[model samples]
Target: MTEETGRTVKPGRSDSRPHEDLKLQLPSERRIHTQQPMSVTAMSRRLPQLVRRAFALAWRVDRTSTVLLLLLQALSGGLGAVALIATTATIGLVATGRIADHFGQALPSLTVLGLATGLRALAGVAITGLSERLAPRIGREGELTLLEAATSAELAAYDTPGYNDKWDAADRGADVSKELIGDAQNLISSAVSLLAAASVLTVLHPLLLPFLVAASVPSGLAAVRSARVHYLGMLATLEDRRLLGLLRWFLVDKTTADQVRSDTVADFLIGRYRQAGARIDRTTDEAAWRSARITLTGALAGGLASLTVWAVLVWLLTSGRMGIAAAGTAVIGLRAAATGLQGIVGFGARLYRLGLYLDDWAEFVELAGGHRIDRGTVRPEGPEQVEVRDVSYTYPGADRPALDGVSLRLARGEIVALIGENGSGKTTLMKCLAALNLPHGGEVLWDGVPTRALDARAAWRRTAVVPQEFARWPLTARDNIQLGQSLRGGDEAVLRAAALCGADEVIGGLRSGLDTLLAREWWGGVELSSGQWQRIAVARALHREAGLLVLDEPTSDLDARVEHRIFHSLRAPARDRAIILVTHNLINAAVADRIVVMREGRIVQTGSYTQLTAEPGLFRELWLLQRDRGRLPVQRTTTDG
Candidate 1:
């Protein structure tokens, strides 16, 4: 619950809230996780886990197309073998001085070559087109997976750095998976080439085939090792990489634009930018150098094996151990076999490398799957009774509980205000009430049912949280509200919510109103003042069909007059639903049915305005101070920001 939205709004106000005496309160409870970062060796240990995801992606795609594509590559490779035989036959005829007479056979062989080439081209085109189609589907699946993970994530996880790193890794893995079809196509081609070579070599000399196949082993192993090293390095660099994003935002973001230009912090950021860039450059250079070294060794080994075959042939020729024609075909088959093995090794290595990342993605996908909500019909129906009993929580890797032992109960349609100073657990407690967070201990009972047993997504369906830092969507004003509702863009419900928040007028004044995108990045888009954006955000939250509304400083950016007016206007709806506001404004505390003041994660006072104000404690002192401060000239007025 938020304190700001409980206040009324003045219908015609165009100024910012100017009450320095008024402030939003904190939550009475908090939950935090305390997990440590995974060691570099742990991430390294997970590389082998990626293979399953790669195979899964390939197998789950259109199977018929996969089979057809492989068939086409096989046809292409068979044509190559046929061309070789035709040329060799022609060579023998030419040596016998009879090639010119065999023009008819040559014409048929050329015709077969042309058809095979054309078919291969068609298969290549089909595979490319199919892959393009499959990419969007894969991307959609990835997004859905990510959304599920985010929705199911423990509330305290949002306050941690590990969550961000895991998210970045998962995002990269998804992107790579979308592009993996190209690698799959290459693998198919390589397999066909190897098969063709093997068939030809068997006829020439079965003994020579193993050496060609064995030559690719070193390159395959090197590629796998290189991929593992690269992934491990990437995992270790998450902190520095995250710092780079922050540095960019601090330097280049539009909201920060004014700050950097006026505060002379651009120079400071430039130094950080240089440091981050140099670090990334060093990593990149090392990886590239290592890859080059591996490639050289693998190539040298392959070349050495090739030279050995030539030496064996020369020895056999000198000793009269093999015929000239047999020797010639063997030479041709060995070269072809080596080429086929190269394709196999190349594809195998790439697939193996890709497997490492896909495994992480696979784990991410599994994580997302683990969080899938059943969307149960069980809901907090009539006369819901929410009780927070002996609840306590702490953040991950932190020692102190953000919220200590706290307990409270509320009936349906009750409007309560939580008042506290900064750092108190007011907001955190409210977030818990909204089911955004769970109690680290004890329970939050919904309609007398323990929240721990309730479906989290279902609880979310009946609740909406408009925090102090609300989201401003990079879309039209209409879309901002529509996003909150079951309906999408251009719906009448969207305009209605805008009207309720007094933002319809702002949209009407725009060049294209609801159609105009709000982001500068979009064509025909425009930016609004923060106050106006806040109003729109309010409307968006109001648009949601929620049974419980938790607004944390929802009107912090609003004018006092407007706040007063909105609270007055929304009173009817507020009385019909469970409304809890977290605010420190004594004026607002006066209107609430009851006020709960928190301090140091504990509820120090809870009562009606007169009850708490008359007591000689924290609430009494805070009220008197605000009451006296309202008279100061330096104090902000009701009109200006």
Candidate 2:
């Protein structure tokens, strides 16, 4: 889902017209477009920053390798210069017009030239070896860095406007981080070669240096302009590309595969994919046309400049301003300079564009995607009591608050059931209580200390949550229950938790029992029914020794017998932890020591199930409706706090 303009566009949902928002005119995109027809001055200003970032990233990944590769490139350039000088000496001796005498005189220069060329080739090989070794390590490091920053951000940041857009862009940058090393190396190599060639040309004839610069300037400008066009196009198509990815996921993901086939929506999804792709293609085509035009213009200008440089060389040689040997060497220097210039311009352009994407990555990392959780340092082992004092929270772009001035308390040895209709804030209140969502107004306190003063990670370790949509991790059955926290009893603890949630039966039937992988996509792995997965999720929470246990619609997928057994088993765990249960099913609420009936983000009534049922309020009203439908038996036992 893309969050923009203070709202989220749900996946697969778009404007009535398929192409309505395909071409984004975001501030970032607009800025890139406005900077179009990129000038030499602007490119020169930007190139150094990109180069520095590239080298910095490479150096961080493998310091010794990065230094070695850089030295090899510099040595290659120096060798090229030495070889050129040696060529000049040989040519000058051979130009004496005395064949046998000059041939003997040229042998030493020939030996020097051959030695430099061989050494340069060996250096190139070493450079390639170092780059190859560094690329994957660099790539992994880049991705790990991005993941660390993303994981540190607050959960609410995912809902903030433009956050997902920047995330997607940064993600793309991380995907190609290895290429940054190559681009940086090529830029350095080309730059060094350009300098070497220019130095030779200046030594041969002072005027030749000016002609070399003149010939290179146009193509360099064109390359920069082309890169800008490509970057701008990427910005324009960002949303469409994301949309296409969403469509592709829907088409291919196992979760949606059955629905697509059974509902015969494959064609519809394909059509959406086609439309999104077409939109991207249009932007890409426009960019290609613009780039082609710039390149053709540059080529034409460069061709004319090259002709002028060659004419000047011939004039110098004819006028005796340059000798036969010097002119011959000048020709070789001219070709070397031209090749070096092309490499510099071409690689520099690519490096600059990739840097734009990397800039997004760097910016996101620095800001922690704009909403990193910055809580206090005080760590709490567990909460004996959690108090909510008039806490209120409103989601971003929301018309109404999800929770408003709601006060409640949870303590150890108590099972407090929060009963509410959809959108009545039971889940939100639970999240606030767990410190997952800090309130905008008032505060939640754990053992007399405000949640804001608690170290977020440390506090979270003391809370176990089972939401309506629980994660189905692709791990071993035992690992799923243990969740990397092995208790003193090890397998015995896992088995006990599984037994409590009735997941032992599910595990027993698996091919590898506790060691069985949960994902069916892998060999020797298995998939579970929705009810079975719920059992495993419950087992996971039960296994964790947390202070607060928040279960939202935990029994939604369970059978009646399992649901009853699970709720009845809660009391044992509640003795050590504060339990907050949220469910629409009134029957399950009967298991709680205290029942809180919420309506429209406010607590309307609070009492024991029997006490609430005796009164004529929202709780009784809901009970009667369910009791009449035979969904709730009138003779269910109630717990006393």
Candidate 3:
């Protein structure tokens, strides 16, 4: 039994094509059948499950806020009913010339009305306060989840279009717990009023009750119509919302402002803002126009219902079947009931729309269940060769794989140097071995044990990577290095890491030394240069007890003299581990135990520097290019790599 439709449908490209509009698609299991008896038993069963989950999430923070918000929500509905009845009764008393009786019920009713208003207002305030408090905690949790997924998602998932959509659409449902609870309160308020009004109206005139419900049809439809329009409007221009968010950040952020003004980039920023604002304006304008049409439909429905109630009242009055005062009061009560019903519909629409966000949020949080990652407890028994299988990787939404059929192996305590041109997939390969990004098709084996079968994180613990960009935590220097070690009370380890990475003397010169806050955002704190920051990042990474070390352009930001000294100090210790160094500077290649030269995602040559320079290939070409540019003779160590 298919449901009746109010609008014509457009033809799609093909039935096999996945729908881009999320709302237009039906949940195959939850499709409605209008021809059947209107039984909501299925929907009702699902409602409690959703509510219970929402309540559980809300309860994670504290019990007080949740309980209080629900209480205020339910109480406010009862008060609205009392206020409506009292007003109608007041009209009746005044018509009958019983002025004193009007004040009795009316004054008490007004008091209830005021109380309800105050509570509702307080509830709004409380929700805002609670959400602000929860945002950071939930954000931290979400960040962790995101970091884990982005770093360790299945190799194939990263290469799929599905993951791409999920990655970009994340912000739409980011604030789930807070918004879900807040929306529940609104829905509860509407439901409570509908229950009260239905009870009161039934007792007044049972036959008229059906007519009241019938009159609600237009307004109820209009509410749902408005919500659909709002959702459509938001979806049509999501890039605009994202752009607006970014533009606002750039305009107001202290970090971006200096560059924004000095580099004449302000015009560019303003242009972006203008384009984003135009899109938002277009979307909102269409919604506002549609909203006007819905508002008119609702108004007509209410007016006709009011006319019906008055006509009924007049019939009773003129027939000498009821007093004028009682008749007037009944008419007022009937009209008030109609309005209350409409309010229920309006709020119900809000709840339905909020459900969209809620559903997306549930899916995002439970992405963990989707992963089902299997991890091993300890590293493949002992130090063995690091072997790369028939590896290939393709990034999400890309035309071709980044690497193809690549295989390599390195024994323990060997230094391997990788030299490649820009975008030759050197960084990507390094990230794979470090377990930051899983490969699209291939396996990495440690001591003959497949990494996929081992505890990925625990394995990662015994590895360190100096990635292209290092994260600068807004903390003191001491705390930054301390974060690397799992064990507490490792001041000696922190000091040793800092000393080994050429950061100890620089840190000691600060007023607070290692205790000094490294971020300028804090009071009395100072910022460091790029080279200084990189040194700190290296020290932090070195603080960990890792057997395999990957250094990706670690000295790129430093001066030539400093870099020369760093290599001299770092060589012996780095050689004791299975170290892989990635550099554009080929002068250091001579010192490595083996040099792997890559070009355009394929390993073109591999040998010692003395052997590779004689081969006519990429390594020689790049070396020649650098030499032509007068960037070389960079203090070559003359060690046989």
TM-score of model number 3: 0.77
Question: Of models 1 and 3, which has the larger TM-score?
Answer: 1
Model 1, span 457-480: residue lDDT tens: 768877767788888788877777
Q: Cα lDDT of all candidates, in order? A: 0.67, 0.87, 0.67
Candidate 2 regions exceeding 4 Å error are 1-37, 630-641
In model 1, which runs have C-alpha deviations exceeding 4 angstroms?
1-67, 77-95, 104-144, 316-326, 369-377, 484-501, 504-508, 511-516, 630-641
482 Cα displacement, candidate 1 (Å): 2.6
Highest TM-score: give the candidate number.
Answer: 2
Rank ordering of all candidates by lDDT, starting from the highest: 2, 1, 3
Residue-wise C-alpha lDDT for candidate 3, range 223-313, written one tens digit per residue: 7677767766766666577667777898878768788888888888888789778978988999989988987887797678657756765
Please give each candidate's TM-score: 0.83, 0.93, 0.77
What does candidate 3 score in Cα RMSD to the true structure? 9.3
Collision count of model 1: 34
Root-mean-square deviation of each candidate, in angstroms? 10.5, 6.1, 9.3
Candidate order by decreasing TM-score: 2, 1, 3
Write model 2 residue lDDT over 1-641, tens digit each, in one string. 33444445556766332434533335565376446666678767788888787778888988999889988998999999999999999999988888687787899999999999999999988988888888888788889999999988887787677778778877888877888888878888888888898999999899998988889988998898988898888887888888887888989998899999999999988988888889899999999999999999999999999999999999999999999988998999899889889988999889878877887888778777787789999999779999999988898889998888899988998999999788999998998899988889999999989998889999999999999999989899998888898999999989988898899999999999999999888665899999999999999999998999999999999999999899889988988999999988898888899998888888989999889989999988888887785655466567632
